[model samples]
Target: MPHIYAKYISKVLELPLKRDNFIVYDRFVNERAELFFVSQDGVDFALTLRRKNNRYLIKYDKATRPASTFILTKALSNLAIALECEVENSNLALVQKKESEVSPWLLKPNFFEKNPTFLDGKQAELEVGFGSGRHLSAIAQEFKEKIFFGIEIYKPAALQLLGRIERENMPNIFVVDFDARLFLQTLPSDSLDKIHIHFPVPWNDSPHRRVFVKKFIDEAFRVLKPNGTLELRSDDEVYFKDACGLILEYKTSNFHVFKNRQILVSSKYEDRWKKQGKDIYDLIITAVKKQNDDKIECNFDFENAMDISIAEQICSLPAIVFDGIVVRFEDAFKSESGAFIIKIILGSVDMPESKYIYTRDGISSFYPTKPLPIRDNMIAFKKLKEKLYGKSN
Candidate 1:
């Protein structure tokens, strides 16, 4: 945990921190703090800004996943600048550092589509929400003939796992920082041998945020090979019951329920739960038949990109849609460096496409990285131009 002691100025400044890409959510769940999503270096983290005793403090405590001090430093720096607070006590300033080495084993969403087809004569296993990656690392070490893909939405936890993987030199383990449901949709039908969800976020109050929903269960079945098992171990009885209920709704017979089942590997939370005398429950779903992949045809390459000025004007429009496709202009930010950033949603309303559109020196493109060349995203991209310039290629 990193802390900064400074007398925060209640009066705000019109700082040039707009490029920091700060998007504030009223609040997430029952927390009194405001959830601030900060984007830096193409990666984003949720920072909580809470007011306590008339003192404003920034915290990086969004989910159960952990955040590093190095990351907190960046978040704090941005908050300090935006709030115009001078740091009186900061440990980050105590250490001067050079550019650190970037981890190689971790993959990004931009590289998902072009990922090489591994033909190493080994079955593939995927673990979603590999918090701290203890279970993932152990499974990878034990199963040398099997390829392991660990999907995590938290970048810092993923980065920490990448360093550990580098030190251990595990050859079969691959880390992907992305939404598991979306990533699972990209896999070939009947390709994976196993899918693991250990102590996943219960999201008890918010059922929609759960990973064990109908769509995810369907995707799991689609991506799992015949007789492949999708295992979920959770201590939350509500989550466990909900998961089993979802599987029952799918009308699958090859499912099993185990109570306090002993496994070769355990996560940090699992160990803690065991020590605390908390009973663990397991819901396993085995795929009995191969499922067909959903078809979506798209050509993402646009013949002609729109002009920046016209694109900016178009981005200012209200929600526009065509045949179930929708686009909404969220916000536009201008940096002191003379760059424009627009946050918008494109595609179907249920799962609209999202990416930062950038304009600088009259050139327009997606920032952080381009969207995965998926069919819906391509349609969304076309809608962006069509809505803005009144025509699209």
Candidate 2:
């Protein structure tokens, strides 16, 4: 999250302010702090202003931040300038980034409204969690005939890759800022020629966060064409062994495990690991059979206004767990207006979405429209809605 620290001025700030293609729509204040909802272009996020001893600490509301940071960074810079306050110290310097500077290769999650047919008839391949974009760029340059898709949740890495794509003029490569697990589920069945998972996070403390899980493997196989491969390269021996065992036990046993095998392209991290005498492992699983694409169907919209009593009760519950769904109400904030800003963590246990639900004048809605349309998330959405507004026949 980009933020800035400025001198605190004992003066009232006006609302509905506009500066540099950004508008501060509403201001919400409570005993704790104040929230200014700012919109840049069509994207929106909140700037939290907290008064310290003699300075104001301004930072982004993590729950409401958009996936890409390009627009948000520029908007924050403009807001800082509009305040006209003396800056103290900040990571987000007052630098404006032009919209034209944004790379066309970058994509938001909404780009996949349904099963994406953007690939047309071209041979499509994907690399999960492209950290440095080196391997992805190398392969895309080598395979000029195939369309390459790279998924990375890290904002900085995604932006860096976007810069590389533009600098190198790789029109065939596309970068998506999203969870690879959910992204795979949104692709048409048997559409991808190959899926690459190179040096994914080990998640030793929490194995559930790893990319080589059973559900993810199932989705990978589903999206891969017949005889197409799902390749996994890692430097973590434990992760490699566990992933191999899981794949062998849960899915088809048609997979191979290699040690220190070199590929066509290598990432810098891989080079460092090899220099340190680290053994690199590779697991290549070939899809044995084709599977049908299952459309994810669910909506986060409420049929009626939210009941205040139900909302209040939800604010008190530690957590609501049903089957594979878990909903936890984290915090509650009251606005100057008669509105409730409730922060919650709900959805699939593996990849729960943390978001804010805004409620005012009886109407309630998710700040960012909706959560990812994964099956577990859909289940959790239904259960949460039922608990909030009661079951609808």
Candidate 3:
């Protein structure tokens, strides 16, 4: 997980008084530190307060970057005021540093919500593994009407593109940092016009980790519009041939192959490889059918809260698989009043939905982050509900 830098302040025996501005969680807390979350206008930021070297300081807890620095800055300001303490290095420099580090639009919480409109029903294009974003950046700028979704799990590459998007102010482009294979399942069928995977990791030694798995190809086929093309450009012959073979595994699929094809907007890696006189390969698979979206029914209400001690024991135990769905409690924390929260994973083994379940005031439910409306999660939710509440009933 990435972290934000902060200067030291006075050491305190315990955390400062809780305020409405901060949303704190103790699941990840140990003897040394506590974690708190803050959200501004639906954009979330994290604060890690800890004591080190006889002094106290705060660090921003972020996996990638915060969507809104302004909110974080304001939250910090409010904290300083509410706590009645003076921060030594408090100035515009700190705020500027946070804002300049990443763009606000990079990690908007409701980004997927806007996908439905998708440039007012214009065609949607997706570029998976958009490293350096050389191709994705140019294409998004060129096609203003089309909504472009660039998926890149690489932190630096995604942030670089985020800066470019902020500079160019391209409204049609949305960048997401997640595995392309899992993210595809969240989309509706026939939602994309074109899909591009350029210069992905070969993962030759760990072939199973490669992106062109059978399930991924099947997902691509399901999400793409009829005649929509899934383009893959690669320099690794192993990956190229493997991807081709995976697509061909489906007897109904048709594709076009190219050798040493030209790249319109070359990435840094591509430029370096091309200078060395390396051969490039391109494979384009066109979908022939418009499949229906997978039915998802993963929501349940829990009104009975379990005991804090029991919840903690459950979280520390191994995962349980019910109805082919794997559900595990990752962490447990008890509040001052004995209210407890458990961070959990619910869904298929490959892509489990990570969220929290809060048992407070004699009730429990999925919380902090809602489980995605998917069938695997629904099944997991049913099993979990039964596991926790069945005995009481």
Best by lDDT: 2
* Residue 379 local lDDT, model 1: 75
| Count of residue pairs whose backbone atoms collide, per candidate | 0, 0, 1
Off by over 4 Å in 1: 1-100, 119-121, 251-253, 288-291, 307-312, 320-326, 331-342, 347-354, 358-364, 375-379, 382-393
- Per-candidate TM-scores read 0.67, 0.86, 0.79
Please give the CA lDDT of all the candidate structures. Answer: 0.68, 0.78, 0.68
Candidate 1 residue-wise lDDT, 1-393, digit = tens: 545555564544343235444433212222354444455443555555566665666656433112234555666676666667655565666424311233456655555467545423459999999999999999899988888999997866777787788788886888887677667766766778999999988989898777788767877887788889999999999889988877777554679999999999999989999999999999888875644556666554434444546545765677887775677776555544455556667765556656656665656666435666654567777776666556766
Best candidate per TM-score, number?
2
Question: In terms of lDDT, which candidate is stronger, 2 or 3?
Answer: 2
Give candidate 3 regions above 4 Å deviation. 1-96, 100-110, 113-120, 288-293, 321-325, 351-353, 390-393
Model 3 over residues 66-148: C-alpha lDDT tens digits?
Answer: 54455666655654454344465445344554443445446433344445554345699999888888888888888887888
Q: What is the C-alpha RMSD of each candidate to the true structure, in Å?
A: 8.0, 3.1, 4.6
- Residue-level lDDT of model 2, residues 8-49, one tens digit each, is 544455767887679986667656777777898778777788
